[model samples]
Target: MAWWKLHKRDKPGSPTGAGGAVLASAAIITRDQVRSVVGKGQEWQAQAWDFYRTVSELKSGVRWAANGCSRARLYIGRVDPDGSSSPTPVDAQAEDLSPDLVARLLAPLEELAGGQLGQSEMLRRFSVHLDIPGESYLVGFDDPTSGDRRWLVCSPSEVTSAGGGGTIRVQLPESQSARVELSLDDCTLIRLWRPDDEYAYLPDSPLNGLQDPLRELRGLTSHVLATVDSRLAGAGMGVMSDDVVPASPQQTDGANPVHSDPVTAALIEAMAASLRDRDSASALVPLLLRVPGSVKDKFEWHSFATELDSNLLPLREAAIKRLAIGLDMPPEVLTGLADTNHWNAWIISDDSIKLHLEPKLGLIAEALTDRYFRPAWEALGVPDPEAWACWYDTSDLKQRPNRAPEAAEAHARGAISDAAYLRELGFSAEDMPDEDEQRRRLLIQLATTNPQLAPAALEALGVRLPNIGQGAATDAVRAPVEISRVAPAVEAPARNEPPALPIAASAVLDDGWRMACLDLAARRALARAGNWLLSRSGRSRRGELAHVPVHEVHMHLSPDQADLAQMLDGAYRDFHAATPGETDLHAAVDLYVRRLLLTGIAHERGLLAGHLAAAGCDRAAA
Candidate 1:
């Protein structure tokens, strides 16, 4: 369905557009019917699974880890022979794919088993099981022979090896048991990084290291709950003298019997009973203990000694940090939201994705490719399943600043060229016109300066003058080059276009040395201004220039484009600053025109800034 699939080269006898179809195949069928497993297989690992289940259910670090991973995007990508060799809006779409085969390959993953769970949500639950038990199982039954199949995530409890290598028995949800072929023929094992490389069956969970801290936390939570309950029940026990007997058997308002001997219990219980349905806004509740002799003098009440669990929250935070570290995520990402700012948050997330999440996602992708995708392809007559497989896009996790406006401003200032500007926006500059506008504008300025010139004179300078009533305006850039009645540029237009100047105006300027000096000065100033044209090449013998490195463009520059354009502009304005004011009338007019023509020629942006370095002096004539 993707656009890049169109360029497939048709080979004789090959199926129509089948080259890019293997990876793009939507549904994979397998002969070994899969049975979705529910498990309780490892009794030795029960405690760890319990830890995972408890924390995952509660508002804890495991929940944070799950939420962080749920944003991942999973898609199948494969290289096409006709893949895009140019820039694409999204960097993830490396190439194009074939639709027919790709659709079949992709069919099962669209709904991802049972029409509810998508790939991301599946991975989320999968990650939780993996992180908690250090091992997770999946049984995908894509029975080409059957009408039903389920890609199921299994618990560490109900699934286990069935006495033999590469065989697993799953306790199905239907309360039936089935033996699964274990080379991912029917079931797959997705596990964490185990230090014991030899024993793939038993992997280590982060909870193993967190056991002591968690146990202490549970104890702390229990103690606090007990303290609160004690407080709620009259805040303490009441001690009464034993000799004091009740006048009569006492009863609460609800007819519950109260032992008359313990007047404190009678009083407190009576108080509690009266307030059960009382108006919450009213602070008063009356209790009649009905104790015989002066009970207040005989009875004494003492509140239990209790201390606050101030370290509970701090300890919980420490536990979350350990979990984050175990999961290879930034601690700040887990529980440090208040401390994160907009600027550093993006950086932290980018680092977390690159360093931690990438490898985990890779493992899951590989498992899916091998156990699910490849087999389905094999059934569908795909000879090479490796060509197309599952891969993840963490683009959602990629946070970056948009510098579009800044890039536009810089390009307008000529600190960057059109190609550089296009590259800034992830666009290709390949088809842009090669013509220079700056040089074209210079030609227009020269011809418009004097309306007195003949039609033939305009042609002599290679100027395409506008129609009769169409007046034009142009800025005359002046540079101090010596002049002797050389009022027009002749012999060559000195641009990418073919020659246009006429032969009648071909008289060389008397002072050639002054024109050369002006050209040399302009080049020097431009070089000082960062030799911007050279940098615009975006590369040099030093490997890459300031332009080649997109991320590094704003970091460093020698003179840069803005400075080059600005300095070259100043050089033009100075060219005619030396036109003598003490000349005779005719000679002064000739000198002004001559210098104007020279300065305009110098300001030309085409063919090496009016061909100053190579042929500017040679191209200019009277």
Candidate 2:
């Protein structure tokens, strides 16, 4: 067989390797030996037949048979996941066998099975690491010529060299049972005198090999073994495949095993029913939206679902009514919710809940329908229900101060202010894509410029105003004005120290003379007639011709200087007028007086305050 080719250099299988060598030795034995030494009935027969088959296969090559005979031995030990020496195997299933007998069988194996082979090679040779100490193995051989399957029981006597362990040999009685109990500690290793190299033997084939049959068997066995390993690793206690096995229970919560436990099935049904009965659901809604096929098998769960189906109309009505009341809407306006099936269908749909909630929105609906209202106007950034109640003292967003005006106004005006408020709250006009900015602007203009509004209030409202966290308000630029800083004119004596004047010109000058001169100067000034000699004295040009300043001042002025400056302005104006666009001293003085009068009038009227301030003006400047 192909397995024989792979084992060409090593001793083959369990106690039978030593049995084959004994067959080669021509030892004599009996059928009672076969039964007592190997095992009973078919077990003994199978071992004997296998030993005979092995001998037949080796008989073709004397050299191969000689090599196998010299290297013959068998050993069994437990392996862990890490491929470490698992010195002792914990008893997963305790039996009623005597403890002392089990102990005496195991101590020798523990001392003998150490560092004989690499971990990987040992595992590759044996499919499972037999629990040597906690398991038992009865090993011996049969004589071929005698046709005897008699075998000897083996145990450790003492540890000799670190490599060579002395073992006890027991020749069994013909009447004894052959099946030995195995624990990790009660394991054994067979050794023999040979003329060739020593060989390590495994009872079972390894997991992966050129041998196809064993490879498949190893795959299934290893998977089961790994599961057991995992359970043992988790808890200190070990379990067998038959104990705590998978029950194939019904799937609930997507994790429970399926169709096994009645109580678990009932609990799952009740849970699913309660979830279905919920009026409002959030994150878990998606999970329950499509019930799992496994849960559908639970009749009680399906029965609970039936109750929900029958009562759905009232449930839908109650849910819609609650949403409407929260929205401060009347039930009639939201009649679309009366169809429970449609509502339920929409509930499970995507963000399309917007479509279902549309009719019930009331004021939100009106604002949304308006061409001037932006979609953002619906965002109303009203805090959530909890916050809304804490802040506004009610969950009703309609009763909010800003939204209160939405009800009284027609759809146009209501949409306008609503849109504006949302924009002020930081929403963009695009958020209300249906609403046009033109109508919004027009509404604002009408509110500010209406003839019916109070003038002052309307004026204040004409400018664009900033809202919270917005840019500064626009303001008008005003010109600055300069006020006279000098004290008002008061009388002061002339350097000449002249006598004080009378109250009237007649008291100082002769009445007849004062009247004749005032009348003559008034006529001369109007007629553009006067001498030019008095122009150099710095007297007014109008005064030089009109003589009014002289007439009034005669009472306040000394008589000696009165005649010192006389009508010379007219001649000066005439001389300056001779040159094109050039004014003489007299004309310039008169022009200056006229300019002053105009500027003073504007200052008194408060027209140039900012302009004068900008120009660095003093009291006389504007």
Candidate 3:
């Protein structure tokens, strides 16, 4: 239960001692709540968070995704491999990351993520805060030992303000009367971007974009619960009039007479839990009832799952897929690996690091580098402070299970190539293992085997094995790091200023707009879909501009080829039948639709103009 030395305001989580009384009672009054001190705002709304008890979609997906990036072993400062000050030795065992200062940073990072329990405990809270709220206000505290700053990850809602000159005002937990204004030298803010909003003071969570799907998920969940209750009540539903009573906890004491129905409810709940698998062959979900003798005859024994499974369970998966898309994660990452084969599951693990984790870890690492660690480095009067970048090693994320047997089987059956087999067994293409290690237990069968040597096998493929002579493995300080996995945190270029995109189709072309019947409901859905599309398709739309013809660009931008146009069309169809109502999302929807439509129109215009200019140049030459 080693805790990060957080600000004094974070006392509620502290062990009962000096701050015991405060921990028991003090309430955190944040900046959002401070607005209500003078005005009569919604007391419950201000006091409580968006979700008092987060369950299902938001809780599960966010936490699962966050876990991938939670245990980031952050290192700062990079020295060139060829440069002075601890250059990588001539041997293979040399440390890739030079400068002992950079290496020593791991200790403090471990302590920072180490919350009341273990290393990941604090990081889990930090990651959850970032994932759910879309922001983590890391209030910096000066480390007396290292002369650096360590941060306590605070909720965005809890921080009243983080203004100029390192002033971070945090809402004190428990029943604290006043907010605590901690005068700090450094504060790092990690923000997940809100779509099309460059100037928003508050950022958005990955969950924020998936609001509609989440609402559907929640609504569907409630509908399922109500349906279950209806079904459960329907069991002895009409027969409850005799001596039977709906048992409360007090009514259902310990014995079957007092609380047999709740126990029956518990059994039914367990049965329902077991049937969540989409491919479950179990058609009949049995409902056993314990009731009074008068009601026993009327009680209908039924299995609701097989009957209703086709209608409902798949809808939940659709919502879950929406969550996965919004989070930029693979659907299997959220739902579980039940649907995928073993090789695909293995590929998913690797893809989890590439698709999902790298971006998040890079963001966090960059923020820590720029604001948290760099400031401390500058304060120490170190030169080239900004040159030092916070980098992450995700060696831990790569769980290297013994895949040799699987690889051997696959390769033996000609299902995979030699290189693929070696890679499957966790050996890199460049720096690979020896003959015996690569062959596993099959070194004795080299004569029986086709390739007589791992070295000779690789030799045929033009891969030269580095001769370490002997004792080279024990001499290396750092393990042969996959250089791809070890990289500097790259901060995305400033996109605050709006890109000069094309005009909207609805406004320009008389018949350009595809969604003619879009109302408020469709508008929100359109906006969500448009934003989802925009978030994935980044600023590099012009990549195809150089190679392809102008007509191809138009076709690419068209609804047939353009993903945004397709998304807008789908959203309209999905929500066209909905009861319309106005929301702030509609405003964003309008903006996004315009932007998405205009982008294509704009590109077409530019390309057309260029094509005409090229033709004119040829005609003038003629």
Per candidate, the number of residue pairs that clash is 31, 39, 14
Residues 1-622 of candidate 3 have per-residue lDDT tens digits of 1122221232356342123332211123333333332122222322223432544655666667667666655554454555454212212222554455443433344445443244344455556655565545555445445666455556656665455444556664445674556553233333222222553444445655666776677778877776554433323222232443433334333544432566555544434443465243321333343455655555554433444546678988888787767765667767676668765666678888877777667666655554344444544444565455556667667755566766776786799887888777777776656775656445433322322254565654556778865543221211221111122121111223323322332232232232233333334543445444433343576553446443224324433223443344345344433423322223333333433333333222322222223323112222
| lDDT tens readout by residue for model 2, 1-622 | 2211111111345223221333211111222222232222223223322332343211222222122222222222222345453212313212532464334333322222222233222221111111111112223233334634333323111111121122223333443442332221122222211111222221221111112322222343444444333322212221122222322334555564444555455334433432455443321221122223432233211111224335545654554444333221223333344555643443333222223222212211121112101111112221121111000001221122333334323333455555565544456656764545655555555454332332334445465434434222111101111222132121222334442432232222334443343334333342221132222223454465465433232222222222222332232344334333322222322222222222221111111222222223212221
Summing lDDT over every window of 10 consecutive residues in candidate 3, give the lowest-scoring window: 481-490
Q: Who is ahead in lDDT, 1 or 3?
A: 1
Ranking by TM-score: 1, 3, 2
Cα RMSD to the true fold for all candidates: 13.7, 42.3, 27.6
Worst 10 residues of 2 by lDDT: 385-394
605 Cα displacement, candidate 1 (Å): 24
Q: Rate the local accuracy (lDDT) of all candidates.
A: 0.48, 0.28, 0.46
Error of 1 at 483 (Å): 16
Worst 10 residues of 1 by lDDT: 24-33
The TM-score measured for candidate 1 stands at 0.50
Candidate 3: where are CA atoms >4 Å away? 1-52, 77-122, 142-150, 161-181, 185-201, 231-310, 336-339, 403-622
Which of the two, 1 or 2, has more TM-score? Answer: 1
